[model samples]
Target: MSQYKINVTKLNLWYKDFQALKDINLSIKSNLITAIIGPSGCGKSTLLRTFNRMNDLIEGVRIKGEVLIDGENILDSKIDLLSLRKKVGMVFQRPNPFALSIFENIAFSLRIQGIKDKKKIETFVEKSLKSVFLWDELKDKLKSSALSLSLEQKQRLCIARTLVTMPEVILMDEPCSSLDPLATLKIEELLQYLKKDYTIVIVTHNMQQASRVSDETGFMLLGELIEFGPTKEIFTNPKDKRTEDYISGRFG
Candidate 1:
């Protein structure tokens, strides 16, 4: 049987003098998509970063409780940080590609893991690009600089780069916020296809996107998780007043 991809218990986060997350508990099923939605500064992004320990790098940051991946606590001291990051890939809100050729950008992570086989690297690069439906558009420009691609293409390249390392869980922070409507639709379609093979956690302000892309939707407000369940239930018949108010566009 497949195990839970990520489990959080009584999780809380603080940035020195300010608290961002308050006792947030969530479980992400294996090979499924979970969307975190809330207004700005509501701690949706903070909770997403906790899955991969991205909060650890912030100065004066303190966390309480446990975050487990595959039955192991990633916050434990004995865990190797590098390996953990490899297994939990992250794609930021922007398409921050490297200043190199398209092929080089995709090959960067594999090379870091000490994979030096030329032919094998090439094949994997191609395969990863194809996973994001970008191989056909980029195959001819393998050696061209990544900066030459369109914004949507660059975002897809970032997805390809993350896939090259074969991460079990992918954390996306407003990944489609910068794209046009058509490009956003394509990414939403891609997310549906990718969830069959990898656990996905996405933070989005777009209510419609969350409803369309996530199997489970979590509504957070004022640093607290107000409601979480099947997307249909949360949207149609939320138990919490806060959830209803936010979803109904009464107020954020």
Candidate 2:
């Protein structure tokens, strides 16, 4: 199998008449964390959504070019969106847990997929929570409402919810923006652990978080990918002046 998990070639996006992404091209490696960093309105989140065709939810959105996941073109009109999303799960900027019990939230995906076996669902839920390091903390409180958990736990639960689907790729959009510093650190650690099994693509405004967690980094500006390389090189020896300026606090 190829080491690269996702390949984007000449990708472009537009919302009605307003173009949101310019020709974006990059290869995301499997079992690694790739971070997309840019200022606000630079199309970070917009580009992230394209992976699972989340942009389709918005009207008048047009896209051109190819996004290949495991050698399959996901942009094809005939592509099964449900299957695509199942393979590429997403964690949003905020922790949006279901208004259900902690155990129910984790089992929801399996239930919807026609998994009616109670024992099977229970096993999957336990495994999912354990993967996110939440099994011990919430094991005794499985019946409690998910909303009753703290913000950090909610975020971890959101991640655990994604894991139940057994996705190959996980996309995060500013997942730590609403979290405190300690909570953010915990999520970063979780990302590190997750990348051992799943490919991770994160859109983050926090440069430090990006530097700390991501193996590869892409710096976007005005919808264009200005520079992409190893995280260390991108931060310390950027090839593009714009990237250097942005990194040095000259301008976002």
Q: What TM-score do all the candidates reach, one by one?
A: 0.98, 0.99
Which residue segments of model 1 deviate by more than 4 Å?
A: 1-3
**Shift of residue 78 alpha carbon in model 2, Å:** 0.4
Determine the backbone clash count of candidate 2: 0
User: Which digits, one per residue and each the tens of the lDDT, describe model 2 over residues 1-252?
Assistant: 499999999999999998889999999999999999999999999999999999999999999999999999999999999999999999999899999999999999898999999999999999999999999999999999999999999999999999999999999999999999999999999998999999999999899999999999999998999999999999999999999999998887
Give the CA lDDT, 0 to 100, for residue 78 in model 1.
86
Which numbered prediction scores highest in TM-score against the true structure? 2
Best candidate, lDDT: 2
TM-score of candidate 2 relative to the true fold: 0.99
Angstrom error at residue 233, model 1? 0.5
lDDT of candidate 1 over 1-252, digit per residue (tens)? 246788889988899979899998888899889999999999999999888888888899888989999989987878888878889999899998999999999999889888999999999999999999999987888999999998889999999899988898999999999999999999889998898888999999999999999999999998999899999999999999889999999987
